[model samples]
Target: MSLPKVRSTTVLGVFHNGEVALGADGQASMGNTIAKSNVKKIRKLQDGKIVTGFAGSTADAFTLLEKFEEKLGAYAHNMKRAAIELAKDWRKDRYLHKLEAMMVVANKSELLIISGTGDVLEPDMGIAAIGSGSMYAQAAATALKKHAPHLSAEEIVREGLNIAADICVFTNHNLIVEKPV
Candidate 1:
């Protein structure tokens, strides 16, 4: 008998005010069995200018991040254009097409979400999330936005992380957070 593989999920949230937050459970499990804990799924890229939250195969996520960062570096003056190009490349990249990973990236001016659909998407709601805990995080963010007026971007991210942590054992308080100047 063969066992099914288990994948880890990371949750990320960004607010309109340029504040970003991300969380990943410390637990990695394989079919109801714990595999590894303390694995980090959130990463800071482009000299701390971009925050990435990823879900799916760790290797695939890292590969995407590296490629995106290189592209962003080439077009440092125009981040929006760089993002669009990267998204397009991601969709067409043969390796990326084969992997199962989704990413949510937050920069100073834009929040973009990239899923396996091979399309780069920007949400009208000024926020994007990826990973298994994303649904829970998104719900928490919506509630926070409705009930907590004037909350800072960081505050919203904190709230989102808290929500994710509650449901996922792989997530904890030690979340990797970064902000652009």
Candidate 2:
């Protein structure tokens, strides 16, 4: 009765020494089937100044990402304003309201998660994550961040996503990482 959604990515974000990195595994699946093994979920916008990772139905996620890019342009590339505007429109617009996607977005100074419910949230510890394997990735990132202060943001993100891929059936080790720098 529902869409054959592929909300299977494990996108993870981490911060270290004022730098932020975001990464996601390359697996996409629907139900018991692996739809794809190397889908690139990470995107760079604003000339690599903004990095985004998404999870959900692939087409829906692409639509939301495009809308988000438009919002960023309308807001003069201000990450916070664009995120809030995207959330507002996504929640209010009937077409967008039904989108089954979530995104983790980052700029050099901020990391945020935006949802279809009109929520734009910043993690308390400079970490953000989304998608089916988020809890596993987030937990691993948190642990790595706390205990491995020397690790780079990208290192933390990579390790976290790797851990998620090990545990989550929907996630795989083909990772793509990006940083806003």
State the C-alpha lDDT per candidate. Answer: 0.68, 0.91
Weakest ten-residue segment in model 2 by summed lDDT: 3-12
The residue-by-residue lDDT of candidate 1 on 64-169, one tens digit each, is 7787778777887355666677777877878767777777777676677776665677765655767666777677777787788588766777777778878765
Q: Which candidate has the top score in lDDT? A: 2
Q: Give lDDT tens digits, candidate 2, residues 30-111.
A: 8878989999999999889999999988888999999999988898899999999999999999999988999999999999
Model 1 clashing residue pairs (backbone): 24-171, 25-170, 25-171, 26-170, 26-171, 27-170
**Candidate 2, superposed: residue stretches over 4 Å from native:** 1-3
- Stretches of model 1 off by over 4 angstroms after superposition: 1-3, 168-174
Q: Which ten residues in a row have the lowest lDDT in candidate 1?
A: 16-25
Estimated TM-score per prediction?
0.83, 0.97
